[model samples]
Target: MAHKKSFEALDRTQQDLRGNSELMGGALVILFGDFRQTLPVIPKSTPADEINGFLKQSFLE
Candidate 1:
């Protein structure tokens, strides 16, 4: 699982995401999912808590 801190690091730096340079150093990252379709299983947590874990706050999103 990806964390917010890691994405912050990438966002802080300048990256060239063109041609082979895209994946030359770091892996090309992508996120695909619909919050309306599914939600993560946070056992014993309320819906609000689960929603709080949303990745939208991360730069990777």
Candidate 2:
């Protein structure tokens, strides 16, 4: 699984490239995963921090 920040960064980049301030630049983004199955890894961080980094916890979600 990818970090929430990673998705946010991609959204920003895509928006900049497409010149649109929309989600993923209005592009269709299909994400496949089970949050219960996997979690993002944050080295030396607490369990709460890792949970907060989940995609489901992201603004896009």
Candidate 3:
């Protein structure tokens, strides 16, 4: 039997993903937030301009 520390490894992986995703916004921008809750510490961008591009070439008809 092997003792694998999964949770500790996951924290580092999640941190890296968050850092990398900060710069990407060209694709489908899905922002999951609650208006009743406080705002985020990091800045966020809405892909309103990219919406037209995505909709024009989306999978849905």
Worst 10 residues of 1 by lDDT: 16-25
Summarize candidate 3's per-residue lDDT along 1-61 as a digit string, tens digits.
1112232244346557666433232233344334223322222435453332332233321
lDDT tens digits, residue span 1-61, model 2: 8889999999999999999998999999998868777999888999999999988888898
Winner by lDDT: 2
Model 2 lDDT at residue 40: 95
User: What are the per-residue Cα lDDT tens digits for candidate 1 across 1-61?
Assistant: 3334545555444254432333223555665667455655567988786665545654455
Provide the overall lDDT of each model, using Cα atoms, as 2-decimal numbers: 0.52, 0.91, 0.33
Q: Which stretches of candidate 1 lie over 4 Å from their true place?
A: 1-25
Shift in Å, residue 42, candidate 3: 40
Which of 2 and 3 is the better model by lDDT? Answer: 2
Q: lDDT of candidate 1 vs native?
A: 0.52
User: What local lDDT does model 1 show for residue 32?
Assistant: 62
Ranking by lDDT: 2, 1, 3
Which pairs clash inside model 2?
none
lDDT of 1 at 20: 33
